[model samples]
Target: MKILLVGEYNRTHWNLKRGLQTLGHEVLVIGFRDGFKKVDIDIEIKDPLSSRFLKKVRVLIYKFFKIDLLAHSVKKQILSKKDELSGYDVIQLVNESPFLIDLKCQLEILKWLINWNDKTFLLSTGPDYVSVMHAYNKKFRYSILTPYFEGKITNKNFQHVLSYFSPEHKKIHAYLTKTIEGIISNDLDYHIPLIDHPNYLGMIPHAIELSQLHYKTPNLDNKIVIFHGINSKNYYKKGNDIFEQALDLISVRHKNKIEIITVTDLKYVDFIKSFDKAHILLDQVYAYDQGFNALEAMAKGKVVFTGAEQEWLEHYNLEEDSVAINALPDAQNIADKLEWLILNPNKIIEISKNARAFVETHHDHINCAQHYLKKWST
Candidate 1:
C-alpha cells in the first residue's frame, strides 16, 4: 500500500512509518518538526515566519493590508509539493487540524488531500470536537477539561479547551468526519469519545519501535531513581502540580533512600537521555491511557507511574497492573504509591520486566502497522 501520514505528534507517525515500511508498504510523512521537540518527517514544512520579529511583522501586515503572510507561506509550500502528494492509497491525518496555518488555510489543504487520496482517515491523538463534547458531557471520569469545569484553570487553559468546541472548529470536524473514510484512535483516552462515531474503525495502541529502545533491568542496589519530565506549557493540564507536591513529600521522607529528579522543558532527545538510568518515570496524572512518553519509558523497562485506568485494563482483558502504576490525581495517594515502590524495590524489577513485555506484546511497531494496514484495507 502507498500511505502518506500527514503531520505528527511526538514521533507517532514517524514510528508508524517505520513499521509500515518494515511490512513492505511505501510510507511518506510531511509536516513541521513540531516545535522544539523536532520530530522526524520525510518532507519538511518550514514555519519560517514564526520567529518573534517576523511574527510582529506578520501581525502588522495583517492589520493594515488584511493579509496573513504566515498562512500564505504555508499554503505556498503545500501547493509546491502538490505533485508528490497525489495518488496515495491512504492518507491519515494525525489530528483534525494537521496544518500550522489558520482554519481557512487548513481547509484549503484538506480539500486537496481529499481529492488526491483514495481513502482518508483521521487519528484521534489529540483534542478534537467529539472528545471535547465527551468531556463537556462528563462522559469520562475526568479529562483535560476537568480543571476548566471546576474553575481551577486559567483563561489560557480554558481557551485551549474552547478551541475544539468552538463553532468554526465544530464545522471543521463535521467536514472531516463526513469526508474521511474512518477514524482511528491510538489509545483509550481518544477511543472513549469516538466509540459512537458511525465511521469509527477501532482503537490501535500507539506504535512503539520496541527494537529501537534498549531494555534494561532496573538496578535495585543503589538509591531508587525517580524521574519526572515536565512540559511547562501543559503543567496544569498534565497535573504536574500534584505530582510535584507528591514528589516533595516523598523526597523529604526518603531523601537518603531515593533520588528524585525533575526536568522542565527539555527537548525530546535530551528528555529521554536525561532519564536513561531512572528506575521509575512519572508520566501524566489525569489520563485514562498512557501517552507516547510513558509507553517509550515502558519499552525501556522502566516502571512508569501513568494512566492505567480500569477501562484500559478491561480493554486489554488484563487482570493485573504489572506494566504501570495507575496514578490518581491526589497528592497523598501519589506519594504513598511512590513510598510503597521505595519500600518494595523488588516489585520495581518485577514491573520493569512486565513493562517491557507489555510493550512487546501490545505496542510493537511492526505488529501495530499490520493492524493499521488491516483497518485501512477494510
Candidate 2:
C-alpha cells in the first residue's frame, strides 16, 4: 500500500511510518518539524513567515487587514503539494487541525486533500472538537482543561487548546466526522470520546519500535534518580506545576535518597536522552493513558509517572503501580507515589522491568502497524 501520513504529533506518525515500511508498505510523511522537538519527516512544512522580517510584515498585514498571511502561506504550501500528495491508498491526518492554522483554511486544505486522496482518515491523538468538548462538559473527571476550569490557566496561555471549542473549529470537526472514512484513536484519552460514534474505527496503541528503543534495568544502587522534563509551552496543560509541587515535597523528605533532575525546552532527540540516568520519569498529570513520550520512556524501562488509571489498567489487565504510576492532578497524591518509590527501591526495579515488558508486548511497532493496516484495509 502507498500511504501518506499528513502532520505529526510527537513522533506518532514517524513511528507509524517505520512500522508500515517494515511491513513492506511505501509510506511518506509530510509534516512540520514539530517545533523545538525536531521530529523527523520525509518532507517538512517550512514556514514562509518564519524570518523576523517576514514575521513583522505578516503581523502588520494582519493588524491592518483581517487577513493572516502566515495561515495563507501554510495553506499555499500544502496545496502546492497536490501532485505529490495525491492518490495514496490511505491518508491519515494527525488531528482535526493538523497544521494548527486558521480553522477555515484548515477545512479548505483538508477538503482539497480528501478530493485528491483515495481514503482519508483522522487520528484522534491530539486536541479535536470531540475530546475538548467532552472534557469541557466534565465528561472526564479531569483533563488538560482542569487547569482552565480551576482558573489556573489564563485565556492567553490556553487560547490554542481552547480554539477547538470555537464555532469555526466545530464546523471543521462536523465536516470531517461526516466526511472522513473513519477516525482512529491512539489511546484511551481519545478512544473514550468516540467509542460510540458511527465513524469510529476503535483505538490502536501508540507504536514504539522496540528495535530502536534500548531497555535497561535502572541501576538503583543508591539514590533514586527522578527526571522531570518540561515543555515550557505546555507547563500548565501538562500539569508541570503539580509535578513540581510534588517533587518539592518529596525532595525535602527524601533529600538524601533521591536525586532530582529537571530540564526545559529540550529538542526531541535531546529530551529523550535527558533521562538516561533516571529511574523514574515524570510525564503528565491528567491523563488516562500514556502519550508518545511516556510510552517511549516506558519502552526504555523507566518507571514513568503518567496515566495508568482504572480504564488503562483494566484495558491492559495490569495492577496499579505495576508498570507505571497513575499521575493525578493533586500534588499530594503525586508526592505520595514518589515517596513510595523512594522508600521502596525494589519496587522501582520491579516497575522498570514491567514497563519494558509492557511496551514490548502492547506497543511493538510491527503489531501496531498491522493493526493500522487491517483498519485501513477495511
Candidate 3:
C-alpha cells in the first residue's frame, strides 16, 4: 500500500511511517520537515514556507482574527500535488489541528483533501476544529460571553462542549462519531467508541525511535531519579506541580536516595540521558498513564509511575512485571508509593523489569505498526 501521512513527522508520525514501511508499504509524510531523515521509508514532502516567522505571524493573525494559515498551506499543497496524491492507496492526516490550535485550518485542509481523493482518511489524533475553537476562545472571558449578546450563534455558543475542548460525555461521543472515520487516540477513555472504529489506533508522542532504539540498562545502585513537572513554560496540562508536591513529601525521608529533575531547562538529548540512570519516572496526572516521555522511560526499563485505575491500565494492558508502577494522582498516594519504593528497592527492580517487558509487548514500534497496517488494509 502506498500511504501518505499528512502532518508533522515527529516521534508519533515517524514511528507510524516506519511501521508502515517495515510492512512493505510505501509511506510518505507531508509536513514541516524538522530535520528528520530515514533511508528506506519517509519521503519528505517538505513545505517550503513552513518557517518559524510564518508560524508566529499565522498565530498572531489567528489571535487577532482567527486567520488560519496552516489550512491554507494544506489546501495549496493538496492542489499542487493532486496528481501525486492520486497514486496512494491511503492518505492519513495525523494530529495537527488541536495541538496547533488551528483546527479551522485543518478542517479547510480536510475539505481540500476530500476533494483530492475519496479514500483520504482524516486520522484524528486529537480533538476536532469546533472543539478546539471552543477551548481557545473560551479561555478568555470576553470571548466566552461574546456568544450571549450575539443571538443564535451556533459555533460560538457557550454550551456544554467537551470531547475535543472539554471532557468526555455522551454528546461528545456522538459529535466525534460524525467527524472522522477512525481515531488514533492518545488515551482510550477520552475518545470512547470512536477508538473502536475499524481503523482506530493508539499513539505515543515520543519519537518512534524510543520504541525501536536499543538502550543498555545499568545495575541499580540506589540512584532514584524522578522526572516530574512539565516543560513549565509550555502547556498547562502537564500537571508539573502535582509531581513537585510528591517530590517535596519524599524529600523529608529519602533526600539522599532520591534526585528530582525537570527537563524544562535541559537540552533534549541531555535530558533523556539524565533519565538513563534514573530508576523511577512519574508519567503525569489528569490523564491515563502512558505518553511519549513516560513510554520512553518505560522503554528504558525504568519504573514508571503511571495511573492507578482499572480503566486506564486496561487500555494498554501494560505488563505487570515491567518497570511500570501505579499511583493515584493525589499527593498522598504518590508520596506513599515513592516512600515504599525508597525502602523497598527490590520492588523497584521488579517494577523496572515489568516496565521494559510492558513497553516491548505493547508500545514497541514494530508491534504498533503491524496493528496500524492491519487496520489500514481493511
The number of the candidate with the highest TM-score is 2
Q: What is the lDDT of residue 117 in candidate 2?
A: 84
What are the TM-scores, per candidate, against the unseen true structure? 0.96, 0.97, 0.72
Model 3 Cα shift for residue 256 (angstroms): 1.6
Per-residue error (Å), model 3, residue 20: 1.7
lDDT of each: 0.88, 0.90, 0.56
Off by over 4 Å in 3: 32-60, 63-66, 69-86, 96-102, 122-124, 127-181, 184-187, 190-212, 233-235, 265-271, 314-323
lDDT ranking, high to low:
2, 1, 3
Scanning candidate 3 in windows of ten residues, the lowest lDDT window is 139-148
The candidate with the higher lDDT, 1 or 2, is 2
lDDT tens digits, residue span 149-249, model 3: 34423443333232245433333334444654555554432344344455455543233455444555636575677766355432223445656788888
TM-score, cand. 3:
0.72
Write down the worst ten-residue block by lDDT for model 1: 156-165
Instruction: Pull out the clashing pairs in model 3.
Output: 11-207, 321-354, 322-351, 322-353, 322-354, 322-355, 323-351, 323-352, 323-354, 323-355
Candidate 1 clashing pairs? none
Give the TM-score ranking, best first: 2, 1, 3
The best candidate by lDDT is: 2
